[model samples]
Target: MTPNDPIDKGDLLNVIKWAIIGIVAIAIVLAAMAGFGQLNVNNVITLLTILAIALPIYYFVMMLRSSKVTKVERSRVKAYIPLFFAAAIFWGIEESGSVVLALFAEQRTVLHIGSWHFAAANFQSLNPLFIMILTPVFVWLWEHWKKQPSAPGKFSAGLVFAGLSYMWMALPGMLFGTSGRVSPFWLVGSWFIVEIAEMLISPIGLSITTKLAPNAFRSQMMSMWFMADATGQAINAQIVKFYSTDTEVQYFLAIGLVSVVFGIIMFILVKKINTLMEGIH
Candidate 1:
């Protein structure tokens, strides 16, 4: 495509729609299989094992039939190594911090105070309700901010927002006295604050990946983006398993602190990375 050519936005939308449909269809089929007792845990494991073995062989065969990469492209790929590491570390810290916090809250003595279970279930609706209420206000604010010449720097702002969200959770613990029963509002508020950070950073991160990766390696680059998420989840699970104890709250607090620290570091690196990305794009 020529530099001045307009992007086919409709075609992009159609591709996205089909991808979502395919994912949903696969999910439905998997659910049906499990429901029918044809897809037990063992069956799932076997399927995964077969796929894992087959994918590399398939890819290698495709490569053999295709032209080899030149040294210049190889160096270009190597240049992304630091970006990948930074992305992975950032994701790992953020997710692991969340796992720690959730575990901490879980370790809290179940308060039978004032219909706690019912309140907790109702609290699940709190976020959606807040979104429904605040969305218009948020949109207006976003538009106003967009018009400003000095709108906040995206990555730095996102990290600051994340830190603020963690602080929201921490504040309730301090205010209510950790041993005493606290309001569910604290958790809900914290979630809402963090969701804002998510809305900001997630899309920007994806945009950065697409802009930076070479055309030939774009798919692999996207896969690595998601792999960072998977890696974070795996690490979270392992950390939770090892740290399971009455000290879950302490673990969570520690994780939150680490997240804040790493987020600050990420914010510091944003300018350098953004400069690198400008050349790549």
Candidate 2:
């Protein structure tokens, strides 16, 4: 397909529809596997390894098929460097915190809910439940706010709320002492906070990429965003490995500190970046 192919709103809608379908399909498969006792940790690891092998092959095919590949000018891309780094930091800390929470907080404690032994890992899904309930309210409020002159500032305020989510874990660490039994609610609460931060940053980042990338290379630019995420995941694995020796309090504190700092930096830069983006658009 040529870069100048007419942009169809329907195509975008279809892509989104298919993506949701794929997610539901995968979820169903995973649920079935879990029910069948085939979705253990080893199986999940093996599936990830397979995808790791497959991703490069898919990228190579895309590279081969496209002829309009013009190098994205470093000067242009460099303007987004701060946002990219912020994104990487956010992703890395969120991922690493999940590992630390699971390993130190969740695994160390077990809840016997009647006849079932509920692993702390299962509680991690609570964030999705919260998102399902809160997303519509958030969207409605966002739309209403957008009608006001000060909407951007109001929107950026969400970042502060997101940053405060880290304190949920921090306060508990201080109170109960990180080594002792703690409620699983903290992880869910932290996830809910980060989810808000995610709502603020991620869509804006994608919109920025859509605007900043050269028209011909927009798909490649979006792919690079995913690659950045993969890079963060690799770095997260390293962080988890390196900090394995540290106490739960130490790891959570470090991750929370990084997140809070990154959130503040991003919030400070958002207005400037918004102006720069206006110039580009």
Steric clashes per prediction: 0, 0
Give candidate 1 regions above 4 Å deviation.
1-153, 174-177, 242-249, 279-281
What C-alpha lDDT do the candidate models reach, one value each? Answer: 0.53, 0.59
Q: What's the C-alpha lDDT at position 263 in model 2? A: 57
Q: Which lDDT tens digits does candidate 1 get at residues 171-240?
A: 6556555665565556666667655655555555576666555555556666765665555454455456
lDDT, candidate 1, at 257: 67
Worst 10-residue lDDT window for candidate 2 reads 148-157
| Candidate 2 local lDDT, 172-245, one digit each (tens) | 65777655666665676777777776666566567766666645556766775665456556556655654542
- On lDDT, the leading prediction is 2
Clashing pairs in 1: none
In candidate 1, how many clashes are counted?
0
In Å, residue 113's CA in model 2 sits off its true spot by 7.1
